[model samples]
Target: MRALARLAVTTLLVAAPLTAVTAAASAVADPTPITVLTSDFEDGTVQGWAGRSAETLAPSTTVAHGGTGSLSVSGRTATWQGPSLDVLDTFVKGTAYTISVWVRTASGSDNARLSVERRTGGVAAYDQVAGNTAVTSGGWTNLTGRYTLATDVEFLRIYVETASTTGAFFIDDVTASYVPALPIQTDIPSVKDVVTEFPVGAAITGAETVTEHGQLLAKHFASVTPGNALKWDATEPSENTFTYTQADPLIAWAKAHGTAVRGHTLVWHNQTPAWVFLGADGQPMTATAEDKELLLGRLENHIRNVAGHYGDDIGVWDVVNEVIDESQADGMRRSTWFTVTGLDYIRTAFRVAREVLPAATLCINDYNTNVAAKRDALFALVSQLRTEGVPVDCVGHQMHINVSWPSVADTRAMLQKFVPLGVEQQITEMDVSIYTGSGESFPAPPADRLLQQAYVYRDMFALFREFAGEITSVTLWGLADDNTWLDTFPVTRKDAPLLFDTVLQAKSAYWGVVDPSKIEQTPPGTSGCAVTYRVTGSWTGGFQGEVKVANTGTTAWTGWTLTWAFTGGQTVTQLWNGTVAQSGTAVTVTNTSWNGAVAGGGSATAGFLGSWTGGNPAPTAFTVNGTACTVL
Candidate 1:
C-alpha cells in the first residue's frame, strides 16, 4: 500500500457554456469557507478538464471575474456538451450547498442553467439539481442558487445556455460550499469484481510444491493467470513450434478449484525465441521491411494459435507487456518489438488477438504509470490504437511499486486520466519492495522491514477502495516472502514483499483484510469503560493493542468481558471479539476472524458496550455502518 502525496493544485473551476450572473453582495469579511462543491463551467482553463465539449475559455466579468476565467460555447441552445470540468473532489449526501457564479447573456432569451450530478461508483453520472434563469444583455449580473444535497450527487456541473446565435456570455466567480453535517455512512467494499489470470494447466517449477502453493493462493485469490510459462520461449521453444505440456498442471488445478485463469502474455520483448529475431541464415536482420514482415507473421501465428487453443477458457490475455518505462525520458522503451516492427506491433497485437479470441479480454500491460511521462506514453499509445480501429479492451498497470516511490495520489491521478479512454484497468503483479540500497546482500529481515511492509499494505488497500469500480483486479506477485522474486532479482537478496511472513504466518498485511481484536473480549474485573488503544504492534495484516481503562470508578467486578461494537457497513467474516475463558488474571482473547489475531500483552486492557448509528465527533470511534458504539 502507498501513501498519497498532497496535490499542489487545490482549487479547481469547471465551467459550462451559459449566461454570466452577478450579485452585489460584498465579499465575506472572513475568508469565505466556500467549498466549490461542483461547478458546471465557471473557472479553470479548458485543458484542465476531461470529456468532449465544444467550449472555449473566454474573459468574463459579472461576479468580479476571479483571476480572469470564463467559458464560451458556440451557437449555444441548451445543448449539453458533457461537463466543462469532469472531475470533482468531495461530494457527500444529505447536506445543503450554495452554487454561485457571475453570468450575463447578449440577449434576454439566453438562459443560464446550473446542475449538480452524481457519478455512479465513480464512473458515470446522473443530474441532481438543474437551476436555470433567463439572462439579459446588460452588465455583469450576479446569480446564486442553493440546493439541498442529494444522496446521489458525487460530481458537479454548470452549463449556460444562450439563445443568441452569435454573441457570447461571460461567467466568473463561482463557488459552492456545504453547511457542515454529520459524516454520512459510506459503505465502500474492499473487493471489486474478481479476475482470473493463471489458467488451468499452467506450470509452476520455481520453488516449493505446486499443490501446496496453489492451495495457499486459492485461499485468498479468486483466480490465477499463467505466471510466465506462456511467454515466447516457454510456449514456443522454436519458430513454428508450440507446446502446452508445462502449462497443463497449473491449468488443471485451477479448473479443479473453480478458479479463473488468464493468459500470461502473447507478445513481449524479453524471453522471445531466437528464430523470430534472426533471418534465414541465422543472423539478426538489418533491413526494417524484412524484420517488420517477420515480426508481424510471428505475432499473427502466435496469437491465432495460442488464443485459439484456450478459446473462451482463459479470461484475459496480456497481448503486449512493459511497453512504457518511467525512466525512459522521452517515451516508450525501444524494445525488440519496437526496434523491428516499430509502433505497428501494438496495433497488430490487439488486432490479431481480436481476430482469434474475439471474446477474450486483451490488455496492454506496463509499469511505473505513477510517473507522468510513462503514463502520457501509455495514454497516447492506447488512444492511437482506439483511433486506428484496434480492439484493445483494457490497460494493465503492473504495480511493481517500491517502498518510497510512486505515492498513492500519483497512482490515483494516473487512473483518473485513463477513465475517459473508456477501457478497464488492472493492477497486475503488485509487489512493494523496501529499498535497502542496490547490490546490498539479502539478510534475515529485521522487525522494521516487516512493520514497513504492513504499513504499505494498509495504505494501498485504503486507496484501492476509492477506485474499485474501474480497477478489474489486483494480483500479488508472489505468495510468500521466500517465494517472492524481490530477493532474487535486480541485484538479488532483498527482503520479503508479500502478505505472508517467511514462516508462512499471516502478517499485518493480512490483518488489514480482517482484524481479530475487533471481535475479542476482555476478562472480568477489567475496567469497563471507553478506552483508547494504541496499535502497539502488528504482523502482516494483524495488530496488537494496549487499551487502558481510566478506571472511572463507577463499578468493579471479579469477572468481566470486554465488549466492543461494530457498525453494519462492513461485515465481519470472522471474530475473536468476545470473552475468552483463560487461566491467570490476564486472559487473551484470540481473534477468530478468518486468518487474523491480536498480539498478547500489546496494550492495556479496557472494556466497553452499547452501539448506535450516529453521534458527535469522536476521532477514535471505530465506525462501521454510520454507527458509533459507546464503551460502557
Candidate 2:
C-alpha cells in the first residue's frame, strides 16, 4: 500500500523516558497498568546495551517496523546470551516496568524471552521478570514482560534475549517503561446486537472459556462456536463409544446464557477417526461394495447419533468440510468418504445431518473462497447440490484472509454467486491475519497499514449489512489472538488476527466494524450528487472498474452514498477507495474517509477489481444520496 501523505515516514528518534512515552493499546491487552517505553530504534545504533557472548547490534534493512533501520542479532543459542539494556540508571529503580521487543526468526526458536533483572553489582541479585514465550518461527512476534524492581537491587537490566536453537533472530522496537491503566472498555455493538436477524459469534478457547469474567462477556455475543470441543475426535474417539462430555458443558453454558450454538462439523476429512474408514477386521477397507456399505454405515451412524443428540438445539451444522479439491479436475476432494461414495458422499452427509437436525441449517464449509478458481469449483459443487434439491441450506465461506490479498470485492463476488441459488451465506471461521510476507511486517504493523486493516473490517461489516437478509451469521474464528490457529498451521508465528488481544480487550478492528463514525467517514446526508460507473480494466473472464461521484447540488455534499445494479451476471471481486456492498443485483458504494466529502461540483472516485462470467454490462442506473444521476 502506498503511504498516505498524512502518515509519511519519519526520520526522527524516539526517547526512552517514561514521561515521553505514549500509551498505545495492544490487540488484546489494554494499556499496561504502568507507563510503557515506546522505542522505534531509529538512532542507527544500539548504544547503552550489553549482552552475553560476542554481541553484534547493527542496523538491518530486511526486517523493520518503520523506516529502513532495525537491529539484527544472530547466533544466540546459550541460555543467557541476548542483547540487554540497562534501564535502571535513567529510569526510577524499583518501579514497575514492562519491556517489549519485536523479534523474528526464519525457522522459529525456543526458550526465547524478555526479562527484567535487578543486580547489586555485576552479579545479578535476582530476576525481576521473565517470559515463557519462544521466538515464533517464520514471522515477527512481540515479546513483552512486566516487572517491578526488587528493593535489594541497585541496577536493572532489560533483556531482549533468546535461548532458542533456531540459529538467527532479528529484533526491533525495544523499550521498557512504567505501565499505566488503559481507559475502561465499554461494550461496543456486536454483530448479534446490531444484526438482530442473525447470530454474531466467537469461538471459545482458553482465553474466552467460561469463567466469572467470561460469563459476564456473554452479553457481548449472541452465539458461540466451540473452537475444538465439538470436533469428531473430541466427541467420539472410540468407534462405538460416542462422548458428549466435552461439548455438554459448552451446550449447557450457551443455553443458560441464551447463546445459540453453531455445531461445527458432523463430518470432516481432517478430524475423523481412522477406525471409521477401516474394516471391521481392523484393517484398511478394500474399495468393494461391502466395504463401502460399512463405511457409509459408520458415517451415517455417527451423524444420526451426534446430530440426533443435539436435535433442535444446534442452530446450524457444517455437514461437510473442504469437500472440493481445486487440484482435481472434477473439483471433489478424494477423502475417505469420497473414496467410498464418490460424488454421492457430499449429498449423503448433508442428507443424514438434515434427517437428524431437520430444523437446523446444514451447510458445506470450505476455505479460500476468495480465490477465483477455488470459488468457481466450490460454487459449482454447492450450486449443483442446490439444483438437485439437496438438503444443503447454506454455503459457508471460511474467509481466513490476509491484510493484502483476496480483496473484499472478491469475497462479495463469491458470496453473491450463491444468492442466485437461493441458499443463505455465512462467513464462518473468519479472521484477518496481518501480512508478514515479503511486503508487510507485523508485531504491530505500520499505522497506515493498520488503518488499512481497520478499513477492511469496517467494510466487511458494511458488506454484511448490505447482504443481511442473505447472510444468516458471521462468526469470528477466535476470541483473542493468543490462541489463534495461525500460531501453528502454515507456520509457527506470532500474530494478531482476531478483534481482541490477549487480554480480551477489543482492538481497532472491532471499532472499525461496529462504529462507522469511529473511522474516517464523510459527514452523513449528502444530497444531489451525480455518479458514473466505468470499466477501468478487463480480461476475458474478469474486469476492473471504478465509480466517480460528484456533488451536483448547490451546496457542498458530505457523506454521500451511491447505489446501482448489475443486470448482467457481472460480479466484483475486489475494491478500493470506498466501501462497496451488494445485495442481490443491487450494489451500494459508500465513501471512505478520504473520499467521503465532495465540495460543490467537486468529484471523487473509487476503484474495484472484479470477475464475471456471461456478461459485463455497465450498470445503467446510478443514484447518489437517493437522487438519480446522469451516467456521464
Candidate 3:
C-alpha cells in the first residue's frame, strides 16, 4: 500500500539577494518584474520548505550552491515526494511570474523538474514551469522558466522533483518574481469585421466580463457561447428544479454588449447530474421500458425549462452534443441516454428544443468530424433522424484540431460531405493545439509551433470563407489561452491554442484570421529528436514509466530504434507499444509494426513497468536510429 503525508515547515521573514533578469519582448510589452521570493538557505534553516508527499526535509551543511548551505530533501518513495513551497498568497491572478531554483543530486544524476500544483473549481492541475533539466552531484543546475497564473485559484504550491529517482537532492537560491501583463493593441482590426457571411464568436466565462478581457471580447467577437454555465449539472441539480445563476450573468453581459448568444447545449454525455440517471428506487436505471420512458420524460422537461428560460436570447442551440462514436457498432455513443432510450433520446432532444425555441437553429454537435469514420457516422445519424422528420437543422463540427494534423483536404471533405445533405454547418469549439500528441508537453508554447498554428488558423479560416453560403457560424473554444479547458484535459500542462495570449493581447493566430500577411512562415523543426521520460506512477520497489520519442525534424521518420543507458540497476520486466532489448545497463527499443511511422513534430510513446535497486537515477542521454536525441 502507498502512504500520503505533507511536511510541516515554518516561513522565514528575512529576504535574500535578488537576481535581475530581462523579460522577452512580444506583441505587448511587459513591465519589469519585481522580486517576491529570495531564499538562499544561508539562515541555516529549512524555512518555507516542505515535502510535497511523504518525505524528510532538513537543512544540510554538506553542499552549497551559494553561501554556506542548502535545503536537503530525502527519504522519498515517489517521484512527487520532494520539497515544495506554498505560494498561495505570493501569486497574483492575471499576472505572469518567472521562477528560478538550483538543484543537484546528492550522489547520482537525475532529470529534475520545477512545477506548480494549482486547484481551480476543485480540480487539481499541474503545470511544468521549466523543461526537465539533467542534474548531477558534480555541480549545481539552474531550473528557470516563466509561468502565467491566468485565473485565481483556491490553492497554489510550487515544487521541485525528479522523474522517477528516489534519491536525495539539494535545493538553493530559489526565487519567484512577478511580471505584469502587457497592454493589448486597440488599433488592430476587429476579427469579425473580416468575415461577412457568418458570425465570428468565442466561448467565455465570468472572468472575461471585466478588465481588458471584457474590452477585447466585446471588440473582436460578434457572438458568444458560455463555456460550462448552461450544462445540466449547473442549471438543474435536483428533480423539477432549475436555476440559471451561472448562465444568467453571461447572457446578460452578451445582451448588454449586443453580442449574440449561442445556447450550448440541451443534452450531452458529460457534465450531467448523476440523479438524472437514477430511478425512483435510488439506483441506476437499466434498459427497461419503464426506465426509457422516465429518462425521456426528464430530458423533455429539462429542455422545456432550460431552453424556454433562455427564450430568444440565444438564437442557436446545440440540441445534442457528442453523440456519435465511430468505434461503436451502431454509430452511437453508449451514454446513459443512449443505453436507456437508444435513438429516441436524440429524437426527443431536437423535437423538444424545436418546440420550445421554434425559430432557433437546432444543431447536433460532435468532435473530430474531420476524420472520415466519425464524420460518416455523424452523417448517417443526422440523415436518418432528419429523414424521420426530426428538426436537425444544422450539423456542428467541433474542429478541435492540432497544428500538424487534419490537412486542408480532409477539412474540405468534411464540409463538402455534409453539403450534399443540405444541412447548415457550423464550426463549433475550434482550437489548434501546438503539440501533435498527448504525450508531448511544453513549459511554454514554442515559437515554431505558434507559427505553424497561425498558418493553420489562416488556412482553416480561408476554407470556411470558401463555404460561406453553407456554413453559418464559427466559434473558438476559448477567447484566449488564459483559461482554456485544454490546460487540464488529456494531461496537465500549459497549452496556448487560442487567438489571444494569456495577457489578453492578440497573437499571430488573431492575425491569421484577420490578415494573413502578418503571419510569418514557420521554420521547420531542427534535424534531431527530443525524448521525454516521465514516471506515470510509483510504489515501494517498482514503478511505471513512459518515454515519448518526438520527431523534432523536418522530415518524417519511419522504422527507428531508440537506445539509452541507465545509471541505476533498473530492469524493464514488462513493456508495451514497442519491442525492448536489455543488456546490463544498456537498453534498446524498436517501434512496433503499427507505430513505426512518425510525422515531423509528432510523437509516439512507449511505457514500461520496472524494478530497481540502490537508486533509480534517470538516464541522461538517448539516441534515435543512431542520431543523438536531446533529453527533455
Candidate 4:
C-alpha cells in the first residue's frame, strides 16, 4: 500500500530501508549467465527496435560501432523517448540480466543509458540497466549495467536513451543475458517464531497468495496486509459498482492458513478514483456545502461497502493513510478529500468502519512518524480525534527506514511520545533500505551495505521489543527484495530491503532479527560513541575522506563534537553535512542543523575533500562530545 507519498518523506530524510529462487539449489553460489538476446545491427534491419513515444528509429549507415550500420534515434522531446525493444517474451523473472550497449551522440556530448520498462497492471516502471556516462559525437562508449526482472509483468521492454539531451543519438551492440540467483534454504526458522513478542507480517498482492511466494509467506508470517487490493481504486473503481477479484484470493489464503489479516487503507489520498471528489456537474468539487456533502456521502458509501464486505475477517484497518503533512502549518495533507469535507472525512471513515466491523482495530497511519515534528503533529491529531470520541484505536508508523538513519532512540521516542495518549501502536510498513540518497543506483546489493542493513534491523528490532506493550505488531512492506516498491520509487534502482533475497532465501537481515549472532560484524560499544574513518579516494596530493560517528549509548546527543588527530599530515580543505575546524594535526568537527542529533544505534556521516602529503593514513583514535569513542 506504500505509494509515492512516503517516498517524499524518505528522500528528504536521506534514508529508508527481492525475488525468490528455485528449490533444487540448496546453497549460495555465484549467478550463472545465459545469453538471451543480441543485436549488432549488422544485418541493416531495424530488428524490432522502435522509438518510444514520439521519437523516430532508423538504421544509420554512416555511424556504426561494430559493423556497417547502427540504429539512430532522433526527434526526441524527452529524456525517456528513445529506441525500445520488447523483452517480455524472452526475459525470465527472478533472474538477473547484464545489458550492454554502445552509444555515440550525433552532435554534442550526452549521457546514454540502458533501461528496462515494465508495464504491470497498467502502471509503467523504468529500471536502469546501464549507462549514465557522457558520450560525444565521434567516439563510441560502451555502457553496461545489470538488472533482475521482477515477477508478474504484463509487458516489458529494454530501451536506450540519453539522460537529458533531446538531440539525436546512435546505439549499437545491444545485448541481454540471464543470471541465475542463489538458491533459498527451506530448513530455516520461521521469522514469526523468532519475534515472539508480537505478530510478524507482510504486505502482499495476489501474486504472494500462490506458488513459492505463498508458501514462504504462510511459513514465516503470522499476519498479512493486502498491499493494494483493499484500497478504494482496486475494490470499487466506479460508483455503486464493486469488485473483489484481486482481494478475495489473498484474504481467503490467509484465512485458510489461520493467519490474521490487516485491511490496508479504507481511505487514502492517492490511488482513489477522481469521481469521489467530483460534483453533480461532473467537474472537480470545491469547498461549497453541496460539494462537501457529496464528498462525505461518497466516502461513507465507499467505506460501508468495502469494510462491510470483509467484516471480522480483517482484524485491523488503516482508517486514514498518509493524511499528515508536517510541512503544513496545520499538519494536514491538503488532499481533495480534506479540501472538501475538512476532518469529517477521517471521522466518517473510522466511524463507519467501526460500525461495519465493531471488533476490528481502526488506526490512523502516516509515514516519517519517527521524525519529532511529524510524530508530534500526528500525536496532536490523534489526541484531538480520540478526545472528541472518534473511534480511533491505534497509531500506525510506516517505519520505512534506511540503513543509515533515525537511530533506535528516535524510533523509541516515536513510540514513547504516543504512550501518554494510551493508544496502541504498530510498525505498519517496515523495510530497511540499503541506499541512503537519491543519487545512488546499484545494479545489485553491495555486501558491506547489506551488513549495515542487518545492523539496522537488529538495532530497530531490539527497540521494538523494548516497547512490546505499546507496539502490538510489526509488518514488513514486502516479503522479499524481488517484489519491493523501492525498485521504482525515489529512483529507478534495485534495493534489498526485506528478510529474504530475490530467490526466496533468508538473508543476513533475517538472521539479524531472528538471531544476531549469525551476523559476522563486531558488536557496537556499550557506551559513548563509535567512530569509523575511511579514505574514500586519493590522488597525487589530494584525497576524499568519510567519517561516520555512531552514538553507542542509550542517550541521544542533541549536539556532538568529534575530535581526532591525523597521523599522516592531512588538511581538510572542505567538508559537507557537518562543520570542520583544523589546527595542524588536531581536527574538530561539529554537526550541522539537519544531522546534529545522533541516537544510539543511529549514525551521522560527514564527508570532506582534503590535501595529504606523502601517504595518507586513517586516524586511530577519536572522541565525540569529549568522550573517547571505539575506533572502528
Q: Which prediction has the highest lDDT against the true structure?
A: 3
Ranked candidates, highest TM-score first: 4, 3, 2, 1
Give the runs in model 1 whose Cα sits over 4 Å from its true position. Answer: 1-211, 326-330, 439-442, 515-632
Put down candidate 2 lDDT per residue, 342-441, tens digits, no spaces.
7677777888887777689988889887788888998898878877878889888888776676777887888787788788898888887766473432
**Model 1 residue 606 CA deviation in Å:** 41
10 residues in a row with least lDDT, candidate 4: 8-17
Ranking by lDDT: 3, 4, 2, 1
lDDT string, candidate 4, 7-96, tens digits: 110010111111111111111232334457777788888889998898988888979976698998889999889999998888766454
Off by over 4 Å in 4: 1-28, 49-58, 62-68, 72-174, 205-215, 233-249, 252-257, 435-449, 487-494, 522-632
Badly placed stretches (over 4 Å) of model 2 are: 1-184, 212-217, 436-441, 520-632
Candidate 4 lDDT: 0.77
Local error of candidate 4 at 606, Å?
A: 26
TM-score for every candidate vs. truth? 0.50, 0.56, 0.63, 0.66
Name the lDDT value of residue 393 in candidate 3: 93
Between prediction 2 and prediction 4, the one with superior TM-score is 4
Report the error of model 2 at residue 76, Å: 28
Candidate 3, residues 584-625, lDDT tens digits: the string is 999999999998998776677788878878766677778899
**Per-residue alpha-carbon lDDT of candidate 1 for residues 410-458, written as tens digits (9 for 90 to 100):** 9888899899999987777777775546754322333344456556666
